[model samples]
Target: MPDNVPMEQAAILADAVSTPFGAVVHTEVRVGESVGVRGAGGVGTHVVQIARLVGATPVIVMDVNDEVLQRSLDLGADHAFRSDDPALQAKVAEKPYLNRT
Candidate 1:
């Protein structure tokens, strides 16, 4: 996560799409670490930043667009890849903080 990134948008999207009853998007891991989270849209750009605030170092972002991938890298992703990659799950798994769900 980059410094000064806000998480409000991700909080809204996660609740709108997956969580019930307007939940808090932030999650704390059992291992006492916060995971890098990429928002599905433009909002995702912020998720990576906020993840850093919560303690994920060297944030990684996920996107299908090449430009967005580049922007994400510019925003401070230590590394990044397309969500559409054939080996997407494998690549994600390579990150210590992000394994296949």
Candidate 2:
């Protein structure tokens, strides 16, 4: 936070940082596609929830457990797949390529 910002908001910003293994529940932490934070678990669940909140379309959640796969879909994921699934790639790429200027 800038020096001109309110102390309360600065305190809120200060609360955002945490170590992964040391994170406490009910506290928000940043975890955007980092090295060890790929697959869905505790922190990963928070990732999914935030992604859903922000309207990430065609959210493909990959996991081996049937129950967890189902849970991903129920949690607003557009699709879920096992790692070795034959159709996973195709299913994820249903739409044609888009040109970026």
lDDT values of the candidates?
0.57, 0.52
Q: Distance from true position, residue 85, model 2, in Å?
A: 1.5
Candidate 2 structure quality by residue, lDDT tens digits, 1-101: 57899997666433333222233223433333212123555544444555655444545577667777777678766666775678866755563432225
Poorly placed runs, candidate 1 (over 4 Å): 1-25, 29-34, 38-40, 95-101
TM-score on alpha carbons, each prediction: 0.53, 0.50
Q: Which segments of candidate 2 are over 4 A away from where they belong?
A: 1-38, 95-101
The digit string of per-residue lDDT tens for model 1 on 28-50 reads: 42223434445435456665545
Residue 65 error, candidate 1, Å = 0.3
Per-residue error for 61 in candidate 2, Å, reads 0.5
